[model samples]
Target chain A: MNGDAYWLGVASGFVVVGVVIEMVRRRYLRGRFALVWILLGVGAILLALFPRLLERAATALGVTVPLNLLLFLGSIAMLIMIMQLSAEAGRLRERTRVLAEEVALLRTLVGSADEPRARSIAAEDRDQDSPR
Target chain B: MGTRGRGKVLVVVPAYNEAEAIAGVVASVTRAVPTADILVVDDGSCDATSAVARAAGARVATLPFNLGVGGAMRTGFRHAKREGYSAVVQVDGDGQHDPAFIPQLLAALEHHDVAVGARFAGTGDYVVRGPRRWAMRGLASGMSALMTTRLDDATSGFRACGPRAISVYAQHYPAEYLGDTLETLVIARKSGLTVTQVPVAMRHRNTGRPSHGSARSSVELLRAGCVVMLGLVREWPVIADSSP
Candidate 1:
C-alpha cells in the first residue's frame, strides 16, 4: 500500500531471507555465488525504494517479465529447477569420471585377449574327470 | 625375421585368471604339439593361473596388470617373434580350443599365410548345444562372409599366422572392444596376405560360463558387425574375387 507498509513487509522478508541466504551461503551458494545472491537482494531493495528507477536497469538486462505476482513466481521456479539440474549433472559427471578410471585400470590389468573364465576351461573339467 | 627352428611353430596362449584350466590346457598342447614351445601370457591372475602354467612347463610371461585379451596376445606375439617361431597360433587357456587341431591349422598354413578355424563351416563333429549358439554361430558366419568376401567363420578365436601376419597383429590389435577379430582378417587380406578359413575341429569349454551372456553376445555381435562393415567398406578393394 504505502512506503511504510511496504517497508514493514520488507523488514520481515529480510529476516526470512537472511535465514535462507545463510543456508545458501554456508552450504548451497558459496563464494562468488553468495555475492551474486547479495547483489540480487540489494537490487530487490533498490527496486522497492525507487520502483520506477531500476526498471531501466532490468530493461537493459533484457528482463521483460513483470517483477510482481505470478510472473515472478514462474521465474523463481525456473531458476530453482536450473540449479537442481546443474547439481545433478555435476554429480553424474563425477561418477562417469570414476567409472572411466576403473575401466582403464581393468583394461591395463587384464591383457586384451580375455579368455573369459569359462572360455579358458576344458571339456574334461565339465566331465568331472579333469584332464591330467 | 624368419620362421623359427626351420619352421617350429610357436603357439601363444593369452590367459587371465584361468588357473583351473591352464595346467590341463598346457598339458594337452604339449602332448599334441610335442616339439612346439608354448608361451602363456598371464595377465595378473589373482588365482593360481600363472603358477599352474609355469608348473605345466609353459614359459609364462607375467604382465604386471590385466591388459585385456588383445594386449595379452600382443605380448605373446612379441615373445613369439623373439623366440624365432616362424608362425604363431593363438590358443585359449580354456579347453574350448582343441589343441589336436593345431596340426590341421599348420597344414593349411603351408599354402596360406593366415588360417583361422571356422565353427560353422557347416561340418563340425559335436553339437552346438542350444539354438542360441546356433543362431550366434550363424550370425558370425554371415558377418565373416561380409568382412572377408564370403568366409565361413569370422568369430573363431583359434587362428594361426605366419611372422608377416603376427607382426601386423602385434602392432594394431584393438585393445578396448572385444570381438574385433574380423577387422584383422580384413586387414590381413588387404595387406597382400591371403586370409583363409581352415576347417579345424572345435570343442566347448568345460569350465565357468561365457563372459558375454546371451544379451551381451547379441549386442556385441551387432556392434562388431557394424564396425567390421564400416572398416571393410574403407579397406575392401574395388575389384571382385573373394577366396584368399
Candidate 2:
C-alpha cells in the first residue's frame, strides 16, 4: 500500500474505534458485541501500520496479491459479524414472542374478568326491553 | 381422585381459533374435573374463541397474537406458577385430549415430576402415519436413549406437570414451534425430574383447522428437527435432583 493509502486506513481505523467506543458509552451497542467492533478496528490499525505483514501473510496463504488477502480477511470478518448479528436477532425474536404472549395473557385475564359484569348489565337491559 | 385428595390442579387448554370446539372442550374438562380450575389460552384467534371459551365457564387468557402452542403453554405455565398451583394438566382445546385421563396424569405425577399422556401406548386409536410418524419415532427413540428411559410418544402435548416442572418451565420454556413437548421432556429429565408416560386416547379435532395438516407436516417436521438440534446445543440449567 502507498503512504497516503496507509495513513487513510489508519485514520479510518481510529474513527471506527472511536465510533464503537461512543456507541458503547451511550449504551447503543452492548459491551459484548462492541468487543467485535473494537477488535476489528485494532486489527485494521495493525494491518495498516504493517503493510509488509500483509504481504508476508498473503504469500503464506498462496494469494497472488496482498490486497486479495485483505479482502479475504475482511469478508471472513464480515461473515462472522453477520452470524453473530443473526444469533442475536434470533434471541431477540424469542424474547419478543415471550413478551407478546405475556401481554396477551394479561389482557385476556383482565378483559375476561370484566366480561361477566358487562354480560350481566346487557342481560338486565334485555330484560327491561322485553318488558317494554 | 377428588380435589380434597390432591393439591390445587389447573387445567391449561391452549387453543388457537377453535371457536367451534372450544366451548365443548371446556365443558367436558369442567365436567370431568369439577374442582380443577380451567384456563383456556386463546392464542390470538381471529374467531370468537376467547368469547366462546369464556362463555363455556373457563377462565380465558387471550393472547394479542398467535404465539403458537409453545408460547401459549408458557403463558399458562406462568399463570399456574403465579397462582401457586400444585400441578398443571395441559389439555388441547381442539377436543382432542381426553379430560377423563387427567386423574391418571395427576396420579402419575405423584411419583414423577412430569406425566405425559401417550397416544400410542397400545391403548388409543391415535394413529400416526407417513413421514410425520417416522419423525416422531426418531425423536422418541433419540430422547429415550438420551434420558435412558422409555418414551413412547415424545410429541404428545397431553401432559401434566408438577410444581417443580411448572416452575422450571415457567422460567425456561423453549418457544420453538412444535418442539415444546420434546424440549420440555429433555429439560425436565436433565433437571433431574422424573418423567413418565401414561396411556391416553386422543380424538381428531372436532372443529377449526388443524395446525399441522398433511400439507404442513413436512415443514413442521423440518422446523422441529432444527429446534431439537438447537436445544441440544444450548446450555440448560441443572436443577437439584428432586426425584423421589
Candidate 3:
C-alpha cells in the first residue's frame, strides 16, 4: 500500500512538471513564473521518492503527522505564490495605465485634427451663405 | 512676466466626459495666457469633449479609453516632455480651476520646481465643508509633516511643473485615482524637488456632475487617505538632482 502511494505521488509530480514544461514550450508560461512551478514539482518528486525524508523532517519540526506537515508547507508555498502574483498584478496594472494613456494621446494626434478642420470648413460655408 | 525668459509653457487640461465645460475652460485658459500652448487631454470621453476642445483652439490628446485623471495627466506630461515644453500647468476641465491663476502658478515655479495653486490659502472664494473638508485637512497636515513642508491643499490639482518636474512626472507619475495631487507631491519631494503653493481662486463647476459627488466623497476621501498612507511605506527610487 505504501509502495502504491509512493508511485502515485511520483506520477503526479511528473505530470505537473510535464504540463509546466509543455506550457513553457508553447509560450503560455513565462520563464520567471515557470521557475516556481518547476521548484514545486521537483520538491514533490523528492519527497515522494524518499518518504523517510518527509517523516524525519516532520518529526524534527514537531509535526505529529507527516501528511499534515506536507499540507502546511504546501499552503505556505501557495500563499507565497499568491503574494508574488499580487505584486505582478500591480505591475501589470501600472503598465496597463501607461499603455492606455499612450493610446489616448496617440489617437488624439492621429484623428483629432480632422474634426476641427471639418468644423472650420463648415464655418466658412456658413460665412459664405450669410448676408454679410 | 517672470515666465518670459523660460521656455514654452504647456497647459495640460485632463478632461473625462466634461463636454459641457471643456470648451469654456479651454477658451478661458486661452484668454488668460494667450501665448501658452493649451493641450486638453480627453480621457476617452463618450461625449463631444474632444471636438469641443479642438474647436475652442486647444490641442486635444484623446485617450482611447478612460484612464481616470491620473492616467490622463501622465499622458499630458509625456506630451509636454516630448514636445520640449519647459513647464507644464495642470488645469481641470470641469471649469472649477480658474485659468486666471495659471500665471501665478507659473510665476511661483520660477522660485520652486513645482507650484501648487492652493484654494484654501485665504484667497479663493471656494469653501470646503463637511467630512470631506475634515479629511482634506487631515491629509494636508499629514503630508506636511511627512515632507517637512507646509502644504495648505495637498489635493489641489491646479499645479505647475518646471522642466525637472515635467521630466520626472513624465517618467514616473502615479496611475492611481487622485494620484496627480497627493502621490505626485510625494514623488517630487522624494526626488528632491522644491515645492511651493500660490494662492489661487477657484470657481464652482458650471456644468456636469463633479467627479466626487457628496454620495461618494467620503469613500473617495477614505481611498485617498489610504493611498497617501501607503505611499509612506512604499520604497521610492532616489533620483539624482536634475533641476535647472
Which predicted model would earn the best TM-score? Answer: 3
Ranking by lDDT: 3, 2, 1
Which candidate wins on lDDT?
A: 3
* True C-alpha contacts between chains kept, each model in order: 0.00, 0.69, 0.77
Report the lDDT tens digits of candidate 2 across residue range A4-114.
988998999899999999999999988678888899889888988888899999999899988998998889989988998899999898878887777765665456557
The interface root-mean-square deviations, each candidate in sequence, come to 10.9, 8.4, 8.8
**If the candidates were sorted by their TM-score against the true structure, best first, what order would they fall in?**
3, 2, 1
Runs off by more than 4 Å, candidate 3: A1-11, A105-132, B1-6, B213-222, B238-244
For model 1, the superposed segments whose C-alpha errors exceed 4 Å read A1-132, B1-6, B129-131, B134-138, B147-150, B215-217, B233-244
Docking class of 1: incorrect
DockQ of each: 0.03, 0.32, 0.36
For candidate 3, write residues B1-244 as lDDT tens digits: 1333257989999997788999899989999999999989887676788888888998888765666788888898888877778889999999999999898899988878899888888896787688767777877788788768788888889999998888788887776777778888888888778899898888988887556655566687788777777665676676635743
Tens digits of per-residue lDDT, candidate 1, B1-244, equal 3344345778788887899999999999999999988888776566778768877888766654555676677776665655566788889888788888898888877787788877666656745455457546766667656545456667667888876776665554544455336676766766666777777667777687766665456676676667566556655432212231
Candidates arranged by DockQ, highest first: 3, 2, 1
- Chain A only: TM-score per candidate: 0.43, 0.78, 0.79
lDDT of 3 by residue, A3-41 (tens): 788899999999999999899899899978998898899
TM-score of chain B of 1: 0.84
